[model samples]
Target: MPELGLDTLKAALPEYAKDTKLNLGSVLGNGQLPEQQLWGTALACAIAAGNATVTAELAAEATDRLKPEVVRAAKAAASIMAMNNVYYRAKHLIGDPEYQSLPAGLRMTVIGRPGVDKVDFELWCLAVSAVNGCGTCLESHEKTLREAGVPRGTVHDALRIAAVVTAAATTLSAEQALG
Candidate 1:
């Protein structure tokens, strides 16, 4: 059986990345997140939160037409970030490459996403990074968004959303506490 590819996605998206030169998740995840950023973020969050069951289930639920770019991005981000963690851990424990900043640029912003208002994406990525405890990734995402003129308030708002979602598990506790 042939696997999924960009041309086989559920939806039609801009053929090219708008401002950004990459849609890393698309390439790495083999063209998963076609153009659905929201979907991709959710899936990515599930993966980052260490819920493999949910991640797999969600990915499976993504049908040919409803498949979102977010889901694919999440998978790709999780996969690459996991590899990155291993490299850093090994280096910290033994010997890391001197120029550690030299990643394969796997997480570079997605193509066709450059023109989309990216404040939300930045925030979402930040949340995922926080959950994964990836300072470098967090910094990179934040810096790029800020440089692109994402206002401070906008960035803060995005982070706030991330915070809320990141603490989604605490909702029950919060509700009980209020009661």
Candidate 2:
């Protein structure tokens, strides 16, 4: 396969998703985040978006910009958040006080030892949570980021990247299904 990147993703989008293609380009390179945070958030959101093409292309671009450990931490955040978002979102939506008191019983040691900056990991998790629509997770991650002195603009940029990546993935899936 030809090397896939943002250009590939943009080209794959149907005309109806033209805005998504434009947004993808803008968010990837014009965000407030620093290089590591930008690429890490993109990679994590791409994984959470669950598009192999998006994930692969973002991973390739991220590898060129981020350290190996940071890349791993980004992937770990996506993986852990995938499970945590579902469990926590369901518990929050169920509105059962009993569920809140119960032990999660899930192994999530990576959250404690992500081998990257804690705030960066939290930001990536926040981005993934946004993609997953897990309000509880989003709130928790946002609070952690805020307490760590991360700027709201940085957080907003991360969410924008997440939104664009998820939208791109969804559009790609729709295009495939309609073909």
**lDDT of every predicted structure (CA atoms):** 0.47, 0.91
State the TM-score for model 2: 0.95
lDDT accuracy of residue 13 in candidate 1: 21
Largest TM-score belongs to which candidate? Answer: 2
Give a tens-digit lDDT track for model 2, residues 21-82.
Answer: 89988999676688989999999999999988788888888998899999999999999999
Residue-wise lDDT of candidate 1 within 1-179, one digit each (tens)? Answer: 55343222212122333211133233323333233544445455546655333344335544343435444545655555555544544444554566465655545445225333455455456546656666666677778878887666654544443343334323323433565
| lDDT of candidate 2 at residue 61, scale 0 to 100 | 84
Model 2: lDDT of residue 176: 72
TM-score to native of every candidate shown: 0.45, 0.95
